[model samples]
Target: MENHNHTALISKLLTCVAACENCATECLKEEDVKMMAGCIALDRDCADICSQAARLLQRNSVIAHQYLLLCEEICRLCAAECSKHQHQHCQDCAKACMECAEACHAHHEPITQD
Candidate 1:
């Protein structure tokens, strides 16, 4: 991938990571924490995957492309879950996840085995 592309994708991934983390933290503070369990779990999973994807992209790892595919999937799932909530943090996280998913989809490249 090109340097500029990598930078942009990494930025999106990191942004998604922050959004996911924040959403999870905020969800825990909601009055009905049990009701937000699914959202919280997806948020944490999305954050972890996005963080890893960003790191792999930063180092130009050969597996980054493949890993991004997984990241995109997780982002979409997270977005869907977040969109179901009315909280401001959840809405923000949904937007971030959707953007990150789009970025990952746009940047996807065929993986070549060494």
Candidate 2:
């Protein structure tokens, strides 16, 4: 069960990283980059944290629960930020962040149990 949860969570985290990266790149291309500064910053932060969470999960870290909780919170914040924009990339990133957060939440119990 833990293996299944880890696998799914890692997949979601990777998806989130990709989405966030793409969103940040798109934000850079916007005419008013300053207006998208917050979104861009959040995208980078979300991607980095999600990547770190995936790595820790891969290692079966004892502190995985704490990392997952942090990842979930960051993902939620990034999603909220992306949701305020109308661009396709932002919209897509928001969807991925939500998915990652949901998967992280699902995997929380097993990590906390042990």
Candidate 3:
């Protein structure tokens, strides 16, 4: 029985997952895909982390905040990689990653049980 209001976090996580996946695929399509091997790898890793984080949050895991922190790190890494590329896809992915990062940061705030 999860709170309906928290669905927004799930949605943002899903968006991050999709963006990272798409960025990896797009990187592979580039003419110099070999040069972006690291970026592609990071994108895949980020996507996986985002998915797992979302799953943990959806399940209301007590330690979900840790996963969200991981997701933020991965998204930042992916965004930095994508920002290095000049392709349109990379630009779009960077924007998405940035948004996801911000959302994760906002959602991970500590709740005081006063």
Whose TM-score is greatest here? 1
On lDDT, the leading prediction is 1
Comparing candidate 1 with candidate 3, which one achieves the higher TM-score? 1
Can you write out model 3's per-residue Cα lDDT over 18-109, one digit (the tens) per residue? 88788888888888879989888988898898888888887788667756777887889889988998888778888888888888887774
Residue pairs in collision within model 3: none
Question: Tens digits of per-residue lDDT for model 1 on 1-114?
Answer: 545448888999999999999999999999999999999999999999999999988888778888888999999999999999999999999999999999999877766677
Q: Which ten residues in a row have the lowest lDDT in candidate 3?
A: 105-114
Tell me how candidate 2 scores on lDDT. Answer: 0.91
How does residue 26 of candidate 1 score in lDDT?
98
What ranking emerges by lDDT with the best candidate at the front?
1, 2, 3
Estimate the TM-score for candidate 2. Answer: 0.90
Which candidate, 1 or 3, would have the higher lDDT against the true structure?
1
Lowest summed lDDT window (length 10), candidate 1: 1-10
Model 2 C-alpha RMSD vs. true structure (Å) is 2.7
- The clash count of every prediction, one per candidate, is 0, 0, 0
Candidate 1 to truth, TM: 0.92
Q: Model 1, residue 64: what's the lDDT?
A: 87
